[model samples]
Target: MIKELVAGVVATTWKRLHGPAQWRILWLKHATFMIGVTGVVLDDHDRVLLLKHRFWKDCPWGTPSGYIERGETIEAGFAREVAEETGLTVGQVAIHKINSGFRLRMEVSVIGRLIGAAEPQVDGVEVTEARFFRRDELPDGLRASQREVILAAGATS
Candidate 1:
């Protein structure tokens, strides 16, 4: 009965809609998710990297993250964002967690290791500050979701 009612509603709604509405419903049925990759990158000492971005409303500290580019692998995008914002290279990465449901966008947290003994060198433009913080002593103004990602990554260490 519920299925029939739903089907009836869909049929009724479908008939009342025009071209754009049809496309919207079609998109709703076959929407592609936008993936934003977040890195829980850590150094050998298990310190988590944090960045203070300039364009943010309050310029809060957060992990290195960006939307995945077309045809770019998740790990590659993760490393790229870190390098672009912090000027630090990262090694291999593996998927750590997936957070979604706010909309069609998804946040993928990946675990990656810092490459060598090099320190971060931010450009002082897009990124104002970049450094690693001890797990127990993260700075103020960290986004709750990012803090949770950092803590969850720490738990797995």
Candidate 2:
């Protein structure tokens, strides 16, 4: 009986000593790999495409953004998100900007040109509406970060 009690105490001490490492192992198993991509579409008139997101109650006016799906490259993910949100096919993608905040996760912004004269069609659940607006004509409800991206795209357009 004493041997059994001593064994229990040793086991408890060991668990307390390595508890953090075990917890880290468990956290890594459940950690989500967060990634996001944004497409900056510009019209010939220097107007930028903006999507009104239905899910975002705090900031509705945002860009066409979505997560990078499993087994997809960043560029391909951006193209897929653009096509899924707005039915326009992207011709070419150019890395416009990159924002990294916390945990080595990144939000990649790419400038995509619409193929031919195809218009944008909002078809995704997240994207409720889509429209092109000039820099000065940006809607008042746009998020501050989105406004910054639109102005940056305007400068390069």
Candidate 3:
């Protein structure tokens, strides 16, 4: 209790010294958490795109996903992750869900349509394979939560 009170006093004094604008910036830096993006990329046939990441152990086959780069909007980051991992462009991007990314990270899930005729070609290093699977016949090893997200995206269109 004494430590908490002392810390509170120090924070209040620091806030007053910095003024509101600087205090807000300092508070945001201390409070904001990491955000990541995942996508349920859909093709013309309504198949959902999935990738086999070389690094994942428990679940190697999953949706195209990555952390947001600095100055990137969630949509832009999602598109970049897809393209970087699978060599496929995505359009019609729309946020489908926002949920816990993992331990303490925040996730933004999006639904996007495949923009071109080119099929998915994995990066070969980070991602060993990329393929689109029919919604009715998704592959094994995909996280159940991701399967639900993909199904939910299919339900909308």
Candidate 4:
């Protein structure tokens, strides 16, 4: 009985130390501040993709963005954001710029070319519309931050 208790404690302790919880603990330890990521996706016509979120109707149209997942690389998370929000696959993600402010979350803007799935598939839940807009003729209600990211990325390309 004593041996069994020791083994069980060891097993549970191992699981807690090496499981998903460990990742979160490590992430928290390493993260001095939270980080966010957004992708500037361009289609064949050089237009940028923007999403209209249903929940944030009052906010302007924004690019596909989300927090980086535990154990996921920033590029992978960026691509995942594009796919989740617009149902579009991205190729060759490259860092455009890093937006940082004192005491504010840092955002990484990545640029990528759309590889497949030209038409966007919005679920009508979170994302209501996903469409490509020309740089000079972007739709109204585009968030200023997103607009700046797009313009800055466009300038470097």
Top-scoring candidate (lDDT): 3
lDDT of 3 by residue, 14-47 (tens): 7677467776778688756788888899998999
lDDT of 1 by residue, 1-157 (tens): 9999999998998899999989877878886878998878899999999888888876468888888887898999899888888878998788888888857798898888899988999999888888889988988888777888888878877
* Model 2 / residue 32 / CA error / Å: 5.9
RMSD of each: 6.0, 7.7, 4.0, 7.9
Clashing pairs in 3: none
TM-score ranking of the models: 3, 1, 4, 2
lDDT of 4: 0.82
- Candidate with better lDDT, 2 vs 4: 4
Clashes per prediction? 0, 0, 0, 1
Off by over 4 Å in 4: 1-33, 101-104
Off by over 4 Å in 3: 1-20, 27-29, 101-103
lDDT per residue, candidate 4, 1-157, as tens digits?
Answer: 9999999997788686855878777768774776699878988888999888777757747888887876788889898888888788998898777888848478888888899757999887788898898898888787777888788768866
Cα TM-score of candidate 1:
0.75
Which 10-residue window of candidate 4 scores lowest in summed lDDT?
A: 26-35
Which of candidates 1 and 2 reaches a greater lDDT? 1
Instruction: List TM-score per model, in order.
Output: 0.75, 0.71, 0.80, 0.72
Worst 10 residues of 1 by lDDT: 52-61
